[model samples]
Target chain A: TQLLEQSPQFLSIQEGENLTVYCNSSSVFSSLQWYRQEPGEGPVLLVTVVTGGEVKKLKRLTFQFGDARKDSSLHITAAQPGDTGLYLCAGPFTGGGNKLTFGTGTQLKVEL
Target chain B: DAGITQSPRHKVTETGTPVTLRCHQTENHRYMYWYRQDPGHGLRLIHYSYGVKDTDKGEVSDGYSVSRSKTEDFLLTLESATSSQTSVYFCAIRGIGDQPQHFGDGTRLSIL
Candidate 1:
């Protein structure tokens, strides 16, 4: 079973549009990470949030960890075609010794 | 990709056959992991190693085995390939501290 769940399994939008993807979980996590994966390439780490209610920004992308540490969100401002790819959220498996459990992915397509 | 490299970028095999994927890292990271990505499932951990000759199973360890005989190499073995096991596999490594994990390009495997 997947410990984390992502909404909007697939998304398509025009460039300059804003969007947000969410990752939710019932169990609390010590840390949460977001990654972006392009076709034929492995997922690359984008950001990591360690504290609850913490928010981090990378370029036009903003990431927020839920206050309870059980959820997270990624918001992209003025999306571009280059932002098209799969977005995945992952959290360390509690008591699993650094093992990470990934969420169902969100495939985003940005059109020009 | 990062310093990590996964061998056999692409492979085709028949069911019941055996296959092995290699992951080599040059950064000398102590923690290494193997994960498989599929539609909707995002990335699922297969196995991981914390040190030489020390390995552990992940959420989807069935039909998959792993080894870490050295600090720079980790091997994933599929004793018997199955159609369900066909997917893009990724190898990742994390160094000591709060640094995020780095991923390899990944190996695309097909089981007929």
Candidate 2:
């Protein structure tokens, strides 16, 4: 089974701080996706990275895929209280079906 | 916001009782998935359906079953509720091809 592991399971930071969350896997994936879930709500898709060493930016958030397609990272710059939520990374095995394996998740709390 | 909705946003029941959670989508997506979020486990896929009357189990499917009789609805059933099964459930839908999946608000189930 393909597994994605996220580091820094819990994070607490003050507003304007910067943080980076990492996701690693032993198996290679064809593509990787990042999601942010708020309390009492389901996860929302943040971005999908498919190329090795690719980087995508969404305002203050920057996402990068590993050079080997075995890892990914999300970096948030000038984090605000609204950035508090659970961050998850997911991917499908190279040849696996449509099913996606999700990471353990990183819970972030940005205080004012 | 991908036109997905989960019924019974909150449910409280006793052990050994049968529970069914419903997922409805208006996007007419070809794939629907059910997942449970726990403290340390993140979001684990319970079941997924690729088409009408076609479904498959995920990593954690021992006590769960799923049915997709129509393109817009996917149902998850817990044969016998257990305290360990209490968690927040989410439903997601993916359109054809490799598009990212969209999710619903989720259902909170408590098994006492």
Candidate 3:
């Protein structure tokens, strides 16, 4: 079975600080997606990267897919209290199925 | 929001009792999935349905069963609830094309 591991399981920082979260897996995937979930709410898709070394930006969040397609990262610039949440990375295996394996997750807390 | 709803946002029950969770979608997506989220395990797929009356077991389907009788509804059943099964459950839907899945708020189940 494929497993995705995320680094810095928990993070706390003051507002305006910058943070980066990483997701790694031994298995290569066809595509990778990033999501952010707030307390008491479901996760919302932030971006999907299909090609290796691809980068996508959504407002203050920047997502990068590794060149090997086995890892990905999310960077938040000038973090704010609104950016505090659980971030998860997920991807479908190379065989192209309707299923996706999700990363362990990184919880971020931005304080004022 | 892709029109997905999970019933009984929070449920508390005793061990050995039978439990059922319902997922309803208005998007008429062709795929629906059920996942359980734990502190360290991230989100593990429990079951998935490809179409009406067509379903498959996921990585963690030992104690869970799923049924899809309509295009917009999928039901997850726990034959005998166990304390280890206590976790937040999420329902997600995916369209036919190359689209990311959208999730519902989630159902929090506590088995005591």
Residues B1-112, candidate 2: write the lDDT tens digits.
Answer: 6899899999999999999999999998999999999997889999999999999888899999999989999999999999999999999999888788899999999999
Q: Positional deviation of A7 in candidate 1, in angstroms?
A: 0.9
Each candidate's lDDT (Cα)? Answer: 0.93, 0.93, 0.94
Q: Give the lDDT of residue B1 in candidate 1.
A: 43
Q: Chain B TM-score for each model?
A: 0.98, 0.98, 0.98
* Candidate ordering by lDDT (highest first): 3, 2, 1
Q: Candidate 1 on B1-109: residue-level lDDT in tens?
A: 4688899999999999999999999998999999999898989999999999999989889999998999999999999999999999999998877778889999999
Q: Any idea what lDDT model 2 has? A: 0.93
| Tens-place lDDT digits, model 3, residues A1-112 | 7889999999999999999999999998888999999999888988999999999999989999999999999999999999999999999855656998999999999999
List where candidate 2 sits over 4 angstroms from the true fold.
none
Candidate 3 chain A: minimum summed lDDT over ten consecutive residues — where? A91-100
Return the TM-score for candidate 2, rounded to 2 decimals.
Answer: 0.97
Q: By descending TM-score, how would the candidates be arranged?
A: 3, 2, 1
lDDT of predicted model 3: 0.94
- Say which candidate scores most in DockQ: 1
lDDT of 3 at A27: 90
Q: Estimate each model's TM-score.
A: 0.97, 0.97, 0.98
